[model samples]
Target: MNAPWKSGSSGGRDQFAAYLCDDAAMDVLRPIVADLGWQPEKCCRGGLRNAVQSLSVTASPNILLVDLSESGDPLSDINALAEVCEPGTIVIAIGQVNDVRLYRDLVASGIHDYLLKPLSPVQVRDALTHAQAVYSAPRSHDAAGAKPHVSTAVIGTRGGVGTSTLATSLAWLFSADYKLPTALLDLDIHFGTGALCLDLEPGRGLTDAIENPSRIDGLFIERAMIRANDNLAILSAEAPISTPLMTDGSAFLQLAEEFRQAFEMTVIDMPRNMLINFPQLAAEVNVAVIVTEMTLASARDAIRMLSWFRAHAPQTRVLVVANKVQSALAEISKGDFEASIEAGIHLSIPYDLKASSLAAKLGQTFVDANRATKAGAAIRDLARLIAETGEAQADSTAKPSLLGKIDFKAMMPRTRKKAQAGG
Candidate 1:
């Protein structure tokens, strides 16, 4: 079990609280609460809904035991409770049902443990003791050198530059190839394709976090993010266009903080406007990947974005990737574009329209669908560059890469010149 999921930092709140719908449950729970040195009077004569109402106004306790016996839709109501509860609260759901599937689902949703009602003092005590241990582990882990985290914010200089494509591919490579647990956070709100690129349905995770920033924690993150694989999970949304995006960007920052503790790498497909509206969102970002095309608009916007990063987030590494490169069709030459931005191009992916279509038709990432193509190879090189940035940060003498270098910078911008250079 993930100890972070059991994260229980009791920030000035009660040590434990319970809302039971029945009197018998309370009679059994009170004695155990007193034994643990928690205030037994904290247990009230209500169910999950009451806990939601009370916690919405006050800080959540270190450990919570909520009665789900009364909830008509326990899973849905659990999500509702998540909206009100603060992070670092270990939740234990008590219900009358004894289905193995239900127990697994509840634990997966961040509950420390689910106790079937007819609550035995011994079973409850043992569960609480284990939850208490889990609650105390993260603080010690932090003291003993927290795991290194890498965060790359992928931004499009202009729309339709395949920014989401590049972002999703990088996340997939980190998880699938490198075997690092990764998260892809698509901040496009109304028009994100981070989940779609992976053939996943965008869940309510991102929107839920936006609506209830306080609810975000290891458990909320585990439940909210739709898993793409064993190692990769994504938080994205297809919010209604009619309903405008609302938030001060605090939720995104909080989500990123939790991710730093939970996963090894996080790739954020952040749109240009969001970055401009909330510059502080990049404060935790380790690298800023500027995805663009060989267009005059892309060059102009990339310059503006480069200057913004230099001014606002100088600590973050900047990588310029020119995507969908078609030398003959390009409005501006790569040399001219680089000159315009005052930065060198880190990687330029040649356009392969057929391979791209094949990826979409099969519902796979570009690199995965067409690994033999130039574009796919270029994307892999980009992934390596981004992955190594974190390694370099953790130790000056990072582990040597097994991959032979692919010199993306040596490839020429013009097709004929590139052919001649290669020959």
Candidate 2:
């Protein structure tokens, strides 16, 4: 008889391997083995890594079945598999028993799918099928040579409300927390703070792409990307003061479109003054996270901008974010800001000056620098909400790494004459 856990679904188990420790489970799986139609080379047992290594040499793409019922070290085996499993490896673990914590741990450690022990061939087949579906599914734009996904434009209604900071932090969050591939495309043109915000040095960034759009492609763009993580990439502004940046041009918009097509998620920290072609960009974007504070001046600008977008590009989603919501000084409430703008507030980010300033100076995101800080918590909450709604909410604590802190000016060796001849 099949294991009780086995179900009806084939689970999309076309070309996958199943590792079984117990003879009983192995025997149960034996009958369905032919039905699975997996390559003989794909099946094996020892540890997760051995199966992973088998697939690595083959490199033809296969599902991994790790029998975790054995007495050997579990964590060690998992670590070994983690080292070899690149982007495509779909790992399914056969656990000893139904343990919630173990399931969570395995899932957290990168296993694609999991099942409890007393494995039935049907259950194994189902898991394998599900895994293959994920593997064979259309590769996200993140992987090389794929069409990019939607882009988010982070713009400020008023100066100093932390648009750059929000963009930087959200990029970090989406890449780090969700494990979604993300690219930060700094579109602020001249005087963009994205490079400074991420603490990345400018070396043929957006400027190069804008000036030479014809030469841009996945490989060229890949080289331009600074690795935010395995999942996240960043393209900073071209040199802020480069003479080529002075003219209003269509090239910038073209670059943005390329970014939109090249990344799973692209975030643009736009310049305050909308350049001539930016309206084209704004219209094409998936989400525009408009940052505003409580003051009347900021609110007025935000309203005007909202109205312009509403009239010109009604199809795009515009999220009016009330940033720095908290203040010692009396300011208009969230309700008032929404009323004045005639647009609903999408998210309210509290004012945490201390954390925000530290993040800016250190060139790290607030979510990284101080997760415990109010601002950091707010951003995390906001990120989760956006991910759920498939929306963008105007969004920092991150401290720059020691290496990230070095700048062009600091890198140059200072010539110290005789320091007053040893004083």
Candidate 3:
């Protein structure tokens, strides 16, 4: 199926920018460039002099690949790009010299990647694809001063129902798929597996973070987390069977609030028994993902939880997800499950014993096991759906009001004012 995120029917052209000055390189890369998902209008080809001149007037591109082999003066090309390339533009330089010095220099100057080319379309596509992937990985600083973060609480109806698994998977997918920073907090004080799930054994995440929640900032949180992958970061204690930790709801809120300040997405895997205080949490959350099973008791409890949110936190979006769905005939169907809970099944992750076992044994998410698995693909789709739907909802709510202008720059850097004419 085609990705729903791709906008259509607006006659909007899909474009990307590429620069190739060498005739030989252009011949080899033209087809490859086409395959990289960019149009001719999105690409600009010229010698070093012409390309540099056009840089000031050209629109910023999502991806830029320049053949530095033909351009003897790489500095000039780099300078031109640095001035006009957008904040997150991905640039790859193809060079003749395989010298480490040149590669290091370009990378240090903020070029995403460098490739030594005799030139193949596959190679160009691969390099550009990788650069786009890396460049799109969201940085922690983006949310530093932007709007408040969205905190999602992923709680399981039963203990062994894989709350930590679901939470970590969702967090990792959010960070990896949407290219947004995500933080997963294991709220289970006595027995939390968030650290184990991501194969991270940090000193003390929640324990240390809660001790002096007042000092929780981006730096502090960064030091507390264990970097799991390119996008996902885990925050929790070291050992699963560790000693008791002192953490009250106030401390939790304080840490969560800081997480909100630092990360684009924050997910708290609240303990199932802690649902007694669901109202309190629902009021503060932007969304709550409730993971349940086919069992009747679990369904009943999920229904109650849904009703609780509907009655109390009407503004919060509650998503019901069925985890470890064994078979089509085991119990309730999708329609019945939704009817029972009175909330649609936002996501249904099929049972993948091999993937789940490997992840559990190695303390990794299924998506990390192998990106091509059924579970991995489903999680990617789920993440994309969540992100797009949220964006659509936000767009719908954003309308020009009585005020002459609307500030659509929610989480972007402030624009510098034009200098006064004679001041």
Best by TM-score: 1
Candidate 3 C-alpha lDDT tens digits along 126-174:
5566555544555543424355456778878776776777788878888
Instruction: Name model 1 segments beyond 4 Å from true.
Output: 1-137, 143-145, 394-423
* TM-score of model 3 vs. true structure: 0.55
What are the lDDT figures for the candidates, one per model? 0.77, 0.60, 0.61
Candidate 3: give the clashing pairs: none
Answer with 1 or 2, whichever has the higher lDDT. Answer: 1
Candidate 1 lDDT over 280-353, as tens digits, reads: 56655788899999988888899899988887667688999999899999999988888888899999999899
**lDDT of model 3 at residue 86?**
42
As a whole number from 0 to 100, the lDDT of residue 14 in candidate 2 is 36
lDDT of 1: 0.77
> What ranges in model 2 sit over 4 Å off?
1-148, 238-249, 275-277, 391-423
- Alpha-carbon shift of residue 215 in model 3 (angstroms): 3.2
Local error of candidate 3 at residue 328 (angstroms):
4.8
TM-score ranking of the models = 1, 3, 2
